[model samples]
Target: MSALLVQPLVGGHTGAAPAHTGLAAGHPGFLSPSGVEIVFVLVGLVTLGAALVTVTTRQLVHAALWLVVALGGIAVEYLLLTAEFIAWVQVLIYVGSVVVLILFGLMLTRAPIGRSPDADSGNRWIALVVSLAAAATLVTVVVDAFRATWIDLEERTGPGQGSSEVTGTALFRHWVLPFEALSVLLLAALVGAIVLSKRNSDAGSGSGSRPGSTDSVPARRNKAGES
Candidate 1:
């Protein structure tokens, strides 16, 4: 659950504080543990529901709409972590741009507006197996990595904005390659989409040329009349 992730950053209820821990002891947070926990649970549920609907819905446009909700919930989660920049990126990139692009593609391809009976690929069994395997792998990795870890927020941040600085450094130093690769991947996908749209338009124009064949009949009739 998402609440489990909050444990390291916000501390659990049993006064588990190291001597140097700044947030776990006497220092008070803006929101109480129960309140934060409740909000996290609610947001998580909304996100999960949206994701499920997005995948399960047969309506293409409705799936995009639900995707927006799921992406918005992720942005909210980032905000709850006080990661403003990440939250804004999620809103601007994923929710706003990507979801819009998806809708545009669906419309451009002339997809059915209502339920598409053929949407299901009949690979539910294989997909379900793969999804469960992936989820179990991720859960195991996360639990093994962070089960006992604790972050003392105040100590980590302090008066110098150390937390953000460190995070920035780590992101740039370690994750830069992956970020750049992802950007390139997105650009390639965008280009492919454009190519596909052009091909579709060309096909449409070719089909329209069929009407021109009827124009020949008028010319032949005129010649016959003149003769």
Candidate 2:
């Protein structure tokens, strides 16, 4: 009777040990990434490439198209992170509305669709230095902030928690001020773009006229009379 109980207890302990070991093995670590992480990294690379092309390309239309790709890649990243609502919103607002608005603005302003010599300001080296500094600062801040933090993703094995309702609630409840501020910023951007385009158009129209605009018409009329 004693031997039977001992044998069963040993078997139970042995079985439980493997269960714990399997769980620890399943947990993801920094060096061991899951499929989702791999996809996320790949999409991030593509997004970065698209963003670089958008900024570096000489053709305005091609840059806008690459901007679309970058924005779409960000949406894909949100989807991969299980924020489906945010992903869809990103697609609808940024990819659909904002990109279309940009294209329309480009067309209405008569911006060059092909390569334009005025695209770059000949400050590539300065811009690169500034960009590298900014990137380094951001990376340092983020790493320092998150280095001590650890998220137990194993506890979240159930369905996603980023439904539209939940996200909307969270946005309105906690981030309402920022949300309104962003809307104001976007409005400001639109107004600024319109103002700049109008100024450019006025400047372009004035460029074709004589310097002494008030006297040129009179001078032309006198010449015609003399002729």
**Which candidate number has the best TM-score?**
2
lDDT of 1 by residue, 76-131 (tens): 88766666667878899998888888999887567788899887799988998999
TM-score of 2: 0.63
List candidate 2 stretches off by more than 4 Å: 1-26, 144-159, 171-227
Clashing pairs in 2: none
Give the number of the best model, judged by lDDT: 2
TM-score of each model, paired residue for residue: 0.60, 0.63
lDDT of candidate model 2 versus the reference: 0.78
Cα misplacement distance, residue 201 of candidate 1 (Å)? 5.5
What TM-score does candidate 1 get on C-alpha atoms?
Answer: 0.60
lDDT of each: 0.73, 0.78
Shift in Å, residue 48, candidate 2: 0.3
State residue 134's C-alpha deviation in candidate 2, in Å: 1.9
Specify the poorest-scoring 10-residue window by lDDT in model 2.
146-155
